[model samples]
Target chain A: MIIKRTKSHIAEIFCNVLCVFVITVVSVNAQKLNDDFFSPKSRLSFGNYLFLEKDYLRASNEYKEFLKTDNNDTVRFKLSESFLRIGRYEEAANNFKSLFFSTSLTDEARLGLFKSLFFEKNFVRFRQYRLEENYTTEKFSHDIDRLNYISYFFDSEPLPDSSRLFSAFADLNRADIKKFYYMKKNPDTKNPVTAALLSAAIPGLGKIYTGEIGDGITSLITTGLLVFLSANNFRHDHNFRGWLFAGFAALAYGGNIYGSAASAQIYNAGVKFNFDNEVKLFFEKHNYFLPEFDFVNR
Target chain B: MKKLFYKYFLLIEIFVVSSLFPQDRLSIQFDYANKLFQTSQYFDAITEYKRLLFFDEAKKYSYKAYFQIGKCYKAGAKFDEAIKYFSTASINAANENEKLSVYFEIVRTNISRRTTSRALQILDEIEKENTNTFIRDSINYWRGWTYIFADDWKNAADAFSKIKSDHELKKLCEQVEKEKVSVTFTKAISYFLPGAGEVYSGNILSGSITFGWNLLFGYLTINSFAEERIFDGMVIGSLGWLRFYRGNIQSAEESAKQKNIAIANKILKYLQYEYKGAKP
Candidate 1:
């Protein structure tokens, strides 16, 4: 009878222990579910959604959260891509560089790094990094080469020989590229010194050369009228009036010379602006000849 | 033995059921996001709301999440983003009242953005769609607010008068209209008599100075011609008399405009800081 009581007591104890165990396990699981709102998995999914929506700032925040407890190549790449889209070049370059040594995305990462440098206008560093074959990939070498050539046009750097530069682009784009190259080499820009010299020889002539015909004519008329007034006053023995008119003439003539030089500078700036716009449009149409990442669609 | 078996089964069943009901989990997330919003952590709240939207597969929180997102953006003064999300919320609204609420939110956002024309257009559309007296009155109220934002005090008064003859906003608008100077009248008066507009706009000192200059230049020009100094007369008339005369008219118009702007700004400041009313 005592042994039977002992078995029953043990059974009761077992039930109580099992009840506590079940409650504890369920409570822990419920707590986890509550915290799942900001879990890494949730962050990654939200980050991907934001990235697809082109909300790069928020996407980068989410990706940063996800990366805290996990290591993911695609997520890292996407994080870097987000920085690039938002014009955060330094962060993007650093993130892309982290994947340079070993990964399925090594080439893509290298390319992304180069793009970050290029967009930041860090052309010198971009060229320096491009020379390291370990940092570049055979698959995208031609793309990097094209970017390098494009960088030359953006700055005062001398272009490579025509044969070397043209070979980097496709046959269809070569003609336009060659045109831009020549335009860069010998830009149709007016010389400011020459413009000043022209204005000195004939009042407002420099302005006319720099494409301000109305202003040039106005300047010429004002200076000529002031000089004529000065000469006529002097002829009439009105010495004070003559000196006043002569002083005004000298001021007008000096101002025209200065204005002509400034006009020439403005004209050169406009030519450069147009040329840069054309080059930018041409490359934008070509997508900068960069390879598309299929993963972005997924 | 059967009783013990039943107890274990119950424990396992509880676990399974708790895991299966993700709605409870979603409710917790919504509360978490709401807590963040209440604390004014708007940027973080937006991310949490977006997460809720992304995970809400049954779309049960679609309207609420989108509406909250709109509110968050509106709080940040991001009117364009607020309007975009409010539009999305309107699409997801489950009932007529819900849809109307979202539409009103968009109109309010547009009002705050100073897109008064669009706000008025939306209010017109809402009035046409709803014939209920309360809704119509609400539309007129918003229309009044829209006109107020546009600095059209007369139209604002007219809109508020539609709601009630003795509406507070209507009285305020009428008072503002009375206090405001007419730019066109000021310019016209200045054309006939130099600096009259500036005086009318309450710049007595500046108006007197401008008038004095005009009188002096006019006298010099006439005296030059009288003295048979044709060159002096021509120069004084073209450069001195004409310049001051034209300047007095411009200054008068500018003074009227500036006085009206000051009047509008006072009312706007009152509404923003002192007046106790529902604001956009």
Candidate 2:
């Protein structure tokens, strides 16, 4: 009877020990699991996965969280790159600028900052930043120079000396770059005032000169028809009809002259548009002459 | 005896702890992302969901994560992105029910985007595969909604009637059909009599002016011809009478189309803003 009582006492102690073990293990494991899920290393792992997937927005979020605890230069560069990829140029520039003085990524970051400024279309600021001796990088100076030369194509600024501009690009790209340079310098554009004078001399001549052959023919036929109708009405002694037709003919003549001038302006705009597209296509094909980053590709 | 007791105690402790906690890292992550979604922080929610996906190496939460991401895009009115993610979710669906749910989401998105033919095609495909009455009914219901979004009230009414003889949506569709002007009738009436189509389309003032001008031109053309002034008759007939005649038909067709658009827009606005039912 005493032995049975001892066994019962042991059973009670065992159950109590199991209960305490379960409570302590569960609480500790839960807390550790939660912490580990969002720990710095875990965030870096997830951020790298997202970055490789090209999901930059989420990757940037993860990288930002990771940066709060770790000061890794590659992570900072990638964070800036993520911003650049997503078109947040201001944020990207700021992030890249933060890596300027004390990181192995100084040159790449400077180039990234220049790229951000260029993409923002802040040409003046981009040029000013490029000219800053302290901000310039020997490693990517040629790349920055190529980007600076490319910027001139986007605006109405006069093209730089052809030799200097061509020298910034590789020999393979020089022909296309030279073509863009010449197109920018001397765009084959018609003068609106000249077009107006031509149309005033002979109806629709200016429209023909502006590459609107169909519109020129229609204009000529319409004005000629109205003038013929006026002369015909006057010959038939219908004075009121003749005067009405003459009024219409005069309006058509003035409208044709105005339309010719507008057509010439449109033609010039088209020429500029085509030139811009070609230049853009060339730069895009060459990746704006920017050096490829092996780390990013990997 | 002590070693066996310790082993049993450890097993009991493990079972109790696992059952009590239930949630692992992935599940906790899912909850965190869901909380972001519940708060209507869609963009952030998408990022969190993506984070879950990136770390969910077992792919246990892939279907839910993708489906939720699709929902986030839909809420943002990014329909193309929504469709793309929904397609991914459908590909990852583990069960027939999950597949059906993703299909419905895709159909609903297509309807919202006004891709009516694609929505109807998906509904048709669902109908062909499933013989279950409840699933068939759901297919018909979505088919009806697709027609309504396409502005084809007649087909909408037909589809809803297949679900129930006296369905409320069927009745609404019928009412919309009644309210809309018939473009064909408007064009036909204008062919018979100039400007009569516009009168039928409820533009009484414009119709009256059109009729008066056409009659005046007709009279002038006939009078000039009767007076043997052929040139005058030709000029007036070609430029005045013919121009007005063609214009009257075109204007009538345009008025009818405009009236139908306004009717459809009114009902659609009600459905969008006031109607308290599940919608595509």
Candidate 3:
């Protein structure tokens, strides 16, 4: 009777211990659930939190952090959108490109990507992408055309139908096409070898072609003065000084030719860039001057 | 009871450890920064000091560190950066003299670097505020040097004369007074000889160029004369040779006067301000 009584007491103690263990485990699991729900695992959740809170800087930071942690194209596309919302098109374009290949958001990303590039003034890349078969962004068609015209500024390579684009853009912008045609006709001004040869024939002819009359006059006068000094030195039998002045005059002459050619090229580039910017500003302000069609059949 | 006590102890221990680790790391950073400062690696030292200023917990030695940074920048001839740190040191200065000295140094550096206008403004303010006579005198002396640097010889002389019997400075003033030349003289000299005045002022290259051109024209004139080309000789000779000859003599006298004045002014600057010995 005593042995049976002891065994029942021990069994009762074991049951109580089991009950306490189960309670502790249940509480721990509940706490873990609360923590997991509060702390998001994916970047999209964090990005939304930042976007909704109107914390653009923090949103940008979170997006960057997300890129580090996960290479999710969807998240990257959203991140590009976030950059666009903040008016950071340069950063947005880079992030959009990060999602360009094999992402479900490729078409949407490409459209955003072109718009971003357009906004960043990267007309050359935008136009190049426009020519690609896979890169169709119907929404930004007018933008693509405008960028194609603007690409003349950024491209160092010779354009195929620059005159046509220049004329088209000039009509749109009310710019003087005569001046553009004048620059196109004068290839000698752009050629350093031709400018140098021309300058050697006459003191300031290269500078005149480069449209730097004041600098041309100054260069001519400076070189002339040095040559005169060299002649005077030779007359005085100062061979060393004569040679030195002659050398200086030669160098100055050469420098003027090279500088004129470079200046001409720089000026031409500037003209194109200015015209491009005018067109870009006009289009951007007028919603790329294209008809907005929101609904798509697909 | 024992398990509960042990659990609370463990919690306290973890909190303590977490707190201590960060503090210890911060102190180590501070020590490292201080070490960099002591080693004459001032550029790196500045970076370390900046980090400590941002992160240090106790915030002790900040003024000392800033003062050291200023000194280092001063040593490196980065006067603008030195001035910045010195101003920071002055703002946090515990000692009045230290603040005054920093202010003085800032003014001195500006004066040395030929920023006379700004230095003069600061000097005026310091003179008004500083009741200390020694500082006041030092400020006045430096003001005199500042005037000298700006080539304001008359004002420099007057400033130096205000100091109680600096014989050497007085002598410099006398020299400037004696050697002063008319502005028209310099113009006249250049007008007469293309570069003769510059030569008189120790510009050998300019003098030689002028002399060479004149000599060439002289030869041309003589050669033309020998060949019975009278018009050519007269034209070249009159147009070039005569002009350069008269120019050379006028430039020589004008430049000599200017050089004497410059020398006198420089002497005054050095004696009154730079020389730390007896005044005379």
Candidate 4:
């Protein structure tokens, strides 16, 4: 009977332990759920989730809400990133500027600011800001220099020599840069007056000079044939026919002269169009030579 | 003491089991997913809904989760993914009502993908199943939208005609059809008589200029040949007369196509922005 009573006593101890265990486990889970749902950092946590999903607008709002009570570098970087994703480069630049001083995120924010400026396509300001005394990250100077050089291609800045270009850029893209440089320096410009004079002196010669071989051949053959016909008609006593052929020949000659000048203008336009396309494609494919930042990474 | 201890342990076990069992654990996740969806985070919403389905032990929200995922994909313009998830929902549907909703979503996604035939086939399936008048009308509405997206205004009109005799879209389609010029006719006319096609298509200045040049060059070539000027005849006939004639015909064909595009664009733009109807 005593042993039975002892067993009962131990069972009571076990039951109380089990009861406490259940209550504590349930309360802990409940508390965690409540905290996750209604805590101060819930919006921040949700914002990070949204950022990972790349929902910039909503994520930015959440970050802004969290920033009302806190001032942290990571959230600031993300807020700027959210602006950058939606093409609000001015806001992105302004936001990025906040994290650009003496923080672990200084390099990232500096890069972000420059990227915003680059994408804003305001080349003048981008160049000017990069030269600003404290606005650059030392580690990313080469990247900034490459972007600065690329900007000159689209703007009025005369391209610098190959020696002055970034060494990293030289290894991969020096040839293209030099080609663009030469095109800028010694453009294949055709003078309209010279082309017209060439066509007048020798029928269709100006079209050949402008690289329109087929048109030049056709014009030369037609003008030559018409002139020959006019001369032959006059020799055969068909005077009226001879005068009409002469008039037609003169018209053809004048039209060819005008067409030659137009062709040169078109050739120059083609040159400009091709150059513009090449520059745009190169910069776009290279992402303006900026480093890929994993800001949205979880 | 043993009896009380046993009673207390039994109560604790019952309390833990009953409370946790009645928690409706997936409800919180469902609400969160819905919140994500409402905020326009479509891609994120898809993940949340998918996660809800993954964690839902009882499969209570499986159908709803899959359907919401499909809706999210459709919003993001990911039509193929949308259709896949919608099909999964249809397969897992507990009743005909669930299946009908899934089918409707499938048709909508197919229309946005510009797959008119696939959308029509689903509509046919819905018809064969003999749904209610409301569903039938909805099918016709989306089918009409599918036709419009496919650029087949005549068929779009025909589709909308099933809903009512004088449906708004049908009337618009009729107007566009009447106003649009026939591209084949323009091409054939230009082949027979250069510049006539352009004139018919309302390009008076271009047609006049084309005809004038053709006439002038034709006269020159014929007169040269009659005067036994073979070289001049050959050069002007091949270079001046043939080039202008071919160019006129080509330009006439192009103008007809352009006019057709312009007429279609007028309707498309209205459908895109101004029309207050259901759109894809």
The numbered model that scores best in DockQ is 1
lDDT, residue A269, model 1? 95
Candidate 4 structure quality by residue, lDDT tens digits, A12-90: 8888888988888976876576445334486777777778767688678778988988888889899999999889999
Best by TM-score: 1
Compute the lDDT of residue B115 as modeled in candidate 2.
96
Give per-residue CA lDDT, model 2, range B76-113, as digits (tens): 99999999999999999999999999999999999999
Residue B266 CA displacement from its true place in model 3, Å: 10
Candidate fnat values, all: 0.38, 0.28, 0.00, 0.28
TM-score of 4: 0.58
Write model 3 residue lDDT over A127-153, tens digit each, in one string.
Answer: 778888667666455555655654454
Query: Local error of candidate 3 at A246, Å?
Result: 20
Rank order (by TM-score, best first): 1, 2, 4, 3
Q: Give the Cα error of residue B55 in candidate 4, in Å.
A: 12
Residue B261 of candidate 1: its Cα lDDT?
94
Q: Rank the candidates by DockQ, best first.
A: 1, 2, 4, 3
**Total clashes for model 3:** 2
Tell me the deviation in Å of residue B126 in model 4: 8.7
DockQ of 3: 0.04
Better of 1 and 3 by DockQ: 1
Clash-forming residue pairs, model 2: none
**Quality of model 4 by C-alpha lDDT:** 0.84
